[model samples]
Each structure stands twice: as structure tokens, then as C-alpha cells.
Target: MANSRVFLAGLCLVLSAAILVYPSRAVTAAPNSAQPKLVDKDAQESIDKGLKYLANTQRPDGQWYPSGSYGTYPTVMTSLAGLALMAGGSTPESGPYAKNVRRAMHYILRVAEAEKDGLIAGA
Candidate 1:
């Protein structure tokens, strides 16, 4: 119970940070609407917060909840994080999360090289 509370608190903090950081990326218009309408800023803020939290809470090795103590955690984390970064449009060259994406990609690649079957190729 205590652990759950801690986790929830962390999640909330991350979400708040995202809303404060990226206000513009909150929403997209629904298709086929007869009238043009803007999205809710507060709701968009909530979504951005969630994304930020997920990104922030990722383990250093790249995985969210990695298992296997013998370096497997790092491998798994890297693969998972790399995929997540990619989904967020992070790349080696540019984008808000370029650095993180590059790092995760590198980590996953290194793990793959070290042990071919150790990590999943795709997150």
C-alpha cells in the first residue's frame, strides 16, 4: 500500500511537470466535426503529464520494470526505452528527446551485440 502511494505520487509529479513544460501538444481535433472546436487545455495537460511521467520514470538502463539481476535489466530497459523514444519521434539528430533516444538506442545496440538473444530487437 505504501509503495503504491509512492508510485502514484511520482506519477502525479511527472504529469504536472509535462503540463507545465508542453502546453501545446495537448490534443488533436476530431475528424468530421461539423463545427470547428478547440481541445481542452486542461485535458491536454493531463495527457502530456502522463507521457512525461512515463518517460521520466523509465529506468536508467531503459526498461520500466526490468527483471533478471545479471545485466538483463539494463538490456531490457534499453530496448523498451529505445522503442518508447522512437514512438515519441526521438532520433539521433533532432527532436526534444533526441539525446535520450540516442542513448537508449546505443544501449540497446550494445546489449544486442554483446548477447544476440539477450534483448528483444523491437520493444
Candidate 2:
């Protein structure tokens, strides 16, 4: 129960950060001017690399770190990682990290389906 609360808090923080750092307003801005100023080239590259690492590290079952330090919070990690990919402009339907997004979504859905309740479990 306590773990779930902590996970919820952390997930909320991540979601809030994502919204602020990657606002929808930036998407409509001129790519040649406003967009470039919001994030630098190197920072963007680093983000790309990190997303790629996350994608590569995903389990064949569509989860990440399912039995390690993050094992206790599979749903939280998956949600946060998926949000990060989305914040970087990738969706399950399109974009560079589409596969990752889709995989995470599928995993989450599977977990939800297996559970009697709507809430996802941490373990």
C-alpha cells in the first residue's frame, strides 16, 4: 500500500514535469525558430539516446526492469517511460519511438486485463 502511494506520487511528478517541459504550445511553434530555442541540439540528442536505451532495454514481455531495483514498480516505470517517449513527440501510432510506446501500452493493458480491478499492480 505504501509502495503504491510512493509510486503514484512519483508518477504524478513525472507527468507534471513532462507537461511543463514539453508543452503543447511548443508543437505549434515555427520549427525553424521557436522550437530550436526551446531545446538545444545536444540536449535533444541526449534525450534521443536515453529513449533508445529504454526501448532497447524493454523486456520481450513489454516490461522494463521487472525483477530488479524497479521490479516492485513495473507499472510506474512503464507509465513514466512511455510518457517520456510521448513527450519527445513519439506516439504508439507514429514517430521514432512508436515501437516502444506501443510495447509499453500493450504491457499495461495486459496487466490491467489480468487484474479484476482497473488499477495496475506494482508487483
Candidate 3:
């Protein structure tokens, strides 16, 4: 309740500020202003490369093998790797790394199914 109240108060303040600035008028884009590109070609290529790397490195069981300091945390690595792939637009049902995503989900589900409380954690 307290959190909601604070959020509402902040939202009201922001809305009031916007009203004061615009005064019920519709805003328009400036003429001749070029539309900003969301991502540059170089940045997009880097993202693609990174996504491919993640997909390639992911094990067939949906787990990522960690090394050195992270070696013991295969669960964490798998979850994070899955999330990164999702962020890069892959889902278990579709997208470039769909098989990997599906395998990851199955791996997590298999672990959770074996646990008493359905928690996905280290064995």
C-alpha cells in the first residue's frame, strides 16, 4: 500500500508537470528533424555476434559450463544465459536460439520436478 501510494504521488507530479508544460496542446515533431535510429549498425552487429556466441556455447542440456570462480554455479550461468537470449529476441518457441531456449526450459523444469519444493537450484 505504501509503495503504491508513493508511486501514485510521483506519477501525479509527473503528469501535472507535463500538463503545465504543454497546457492541453498536442506536441509535434520538429520539421526536418531526422528520426533517431534506435541502434547503429555496428552495435547491432555486435549484439548479433554476442547472441550467436551465447547460443553456440550453451550446452545441449541448456546448461552453460562456467569456469574458474563461476565453475560451481552452472545453474546461475544457465539462467542468465537464457535470459540474455530472451533479451536478444529468442524464445523457447521461436527465434534464432529457440532450441537452446527450449532445452534450457526443459533442464530447469527437470530439476524443479525432482526437488521437493519445485525450486530450481543446485543439486
User: Clash totals for all models, in order?
Assistant: 3, 0, 0
List of clashing residue pairs for candidate 1: 15-49, 62-77, 63-77
Model 3 — which ten-residue stretch has the worst lDDT? 13-22
lDDT, candidate 2, equals 0.71
Highest lDDT model number: 2
Model 1 compared with the native: what TM-score? 0.45
Full candidate order by lDDT, most accurate first: 2, 3, 1
Q: After superposing candidate 3, which stretches have Cα over 4 Å from the reference?
A: 1-35
Instruction: Give a tens-digit lDDT track for model 3, residues 5-85.
Output: 445534443354344334543565554648886689999999999989988998877788887773477777777787777
Model 2, 3-83: lDDT tens digits are: 564456445644654564557974655456434375688988999899888888888777786567633788778878888
Runs with alpha carbons beyond 4 Å of true place in candidate 2:
1-36, 66-71
Report, for every candidate in turn, its global Cα lDDT versus the true structure.
0.53, 0.71, 0.68
Residue 99's C-alpha lDDT in candidate 1?
A: 62
Q: Model 1, range 1-123, lDDT digits (tens) per residue? A: 444544553444345435434555446344676875555778667756755765676656544665556544555565555555545545555566666655555555444445434433443
Question: 81, model 2: CA deviation in Å?
Answer: 0.7
True-vs-predicted CA distance for residue 101, candidate 3, Å: 0.6
Estimate the TM-score for candidate 2. Answer: 0.66
